[model samples]
Target: MFAPIRWLILALQFATILPTPSVRTATERDIRCSVVWFPVIGMLLGVLLWVFQSFFVHHMPSLAASVVSLSIYTLATGALHLDGLMDTADAMGSRRPREAALEIMKDSRVGAMGVVVCLFAILGKWSAIASISPDHWEPFVVVPMMSRLGMIWSMVVAPSARSQGLGALFARKIPRWTVAVATCLCGAVCGLVLPFQQCLWVLLYAILTVTLFTGWMVHRFGGTTGDTYGALNEIMEWVGWYVFLCASA
Candidate 1:
């Protein structure tokens, strides 16, 4: 229990831009152990976004408030997942051999596809937020948590694309029990934090969306990578928001 507590802190450190003491000697195994807390970090992010929206929505136009909320979300995650989404887009758009696609993803320079997808992701999110009433902000809290759960699901269902790196570490290490616990945590948290039907709606769609994404990724790359995990999070986030908007309506 104590060890997992430490791992949870480590997970928070890796997953967010929140201030955390540097873990200079943390091992790969430690990083793998942190998988259990991935959704926990997402939950925290959701809470923060909800609080931000709550504080600002009453003061500004919904679109403006939505943009501000999205900006805060970007900063909090250090744009890490967005970067992955772009890179994955570039790779997928290249439609080259797996090795070549991987190489494109490794490139630091953003390509046209990367730029377009990044724009789509941010703009789509902005529009989704704008579409909903500010009073219905519970979806903001639920979506991030569901998206992070998508990441964990991808890790469990797919093998690593590369021989080494964070993807490999997570692929080789996430325990089945950890995935189970994370799933249960997600359900419990959603049930408590959101309307019951909306909660189920989010979870069901999140899982199915991720399942389709995982299948496509596996077919394309023969496995998953860190970038795809991030991509999954981004895609699932949009899905969650859209689902919430529809369900709440």
Candidate 2:
């Protein structure tokens, strides 16, 4: 298999529940390079979602169709980012010292705060999907693509909170140039499907929101973690939907 193709496959394996050929000899460099493919995988997921929603909305209530689409979306990604959101919420909601909060984030147990935040995240996306005009399908693709792009940005700009874990590994090994490449890919996708002005607004919203959110995470956790990266992705998805909805409006 070609190296770039393998890297892309590794990325799909890591970020999604979608089945792919296993890379038994995947190197650390491969792992790092795979970050470049995150947005692509997101776009793929978005396409899946957009198609599913378009089909189901015709056969069922819009709300029910949205719920089913959202469920498929969650399952497709294995709810990996949602779990991150929950863990990060529990940690931040603990109001503990930075180190202790990090500890809370590491625990497998979900807390009350985690549940509340996760619920809100789901509801936010659901409402946005249900409320969106049936003619507006760009949000389905752009939102996922932009959110994953936001993850790449967060990983690049923020220091890792710990010396270990997936976040630190990515932060340490992912090439800085990967950010430019990923952003360009994301921009091209958005521009193809969205109005020029709306594309620009969506991109700006993603950059600004991710930047501000990263800063807050740094202040609270001293740096980004794997959990926080996931948290950012979820946050971007929720907010990205609304931004697109407004842009289209």
Candidate 3:
């Protein structure tokens, strides 16, 4: 087995745009093995956001802090999930035959639907973050973790929409054992950072959101794709934010 730190580095390297230890010769198996560390990446991201919030929340208005925080979020991950969201939106909005819709998603150019989705997603998250009370900031840490867990769940439950690409690698290579272990780890992390009731609720929400979205992807394109996986992560974050909002309310 790859050392735990190696796996974690790989996960961090893949999930974020941050500089990390080189793995120039990393194989598909190495990447597959890294799947288990995905939640750790999320937790790392949450902690960074938490620290950013600490600095910003004390100095700036909530709305400004929220915008800056969201910008940090985009930079940290290179807006990888947001790109997925946009591509998926473009594909879904095409309303063409399955192949044609997939073609639209594969195109490098963003479509009108993609623009609309990105606009609203950013606006919605900014609004939610700004509105949330500081006392409930713990949910901020848990939300990112839940969203990464959502990505794993999507890979576990859905076939790849295409024969090649990141989605296929994950769908085919990630074992059921990894998913099981990851779930336990995520549960542990959530339990540590959130109330038992809220942790359970977010867990349920992540599962249902991933399952439902993957099912829709299957119905539309015969399976999931890298783009859809990204979309799933983005949507799950939104779900987390809204759930946190409602819970805090």
Q: Give model 1 RMSD, 1 decimal.
A: 1.6
RMSD of each: 1.6, 1.1, 1.5
> Each model's C-alpha lDDT?
0.85, 0.88, 0.85
Let me know the TM-score candidate 3 reaches against the reference structure. Answer: 0.95
Backbone Cα, N, C clashes tallied per candidate: 0, 0, 1
lDDT of 3 at 53: 65
TM-score of 1: 0.94
lDDT of 1: 0.85
* TM-score per model over all chains: 0.94, 0.97, 0.95
Which residue pairs in candidate 2 have backbone atoms (N, alpha carbon, C) closer than 3 angstroms, thus clashing? none
Whichever of 1 and 2 has more TM-score, that candidate is 2
Task: Give the range where candidate 2 is weakest over 10 consecutive residues by summed lDDT.
Answer: 170-179
Best model number under lDDT: 2
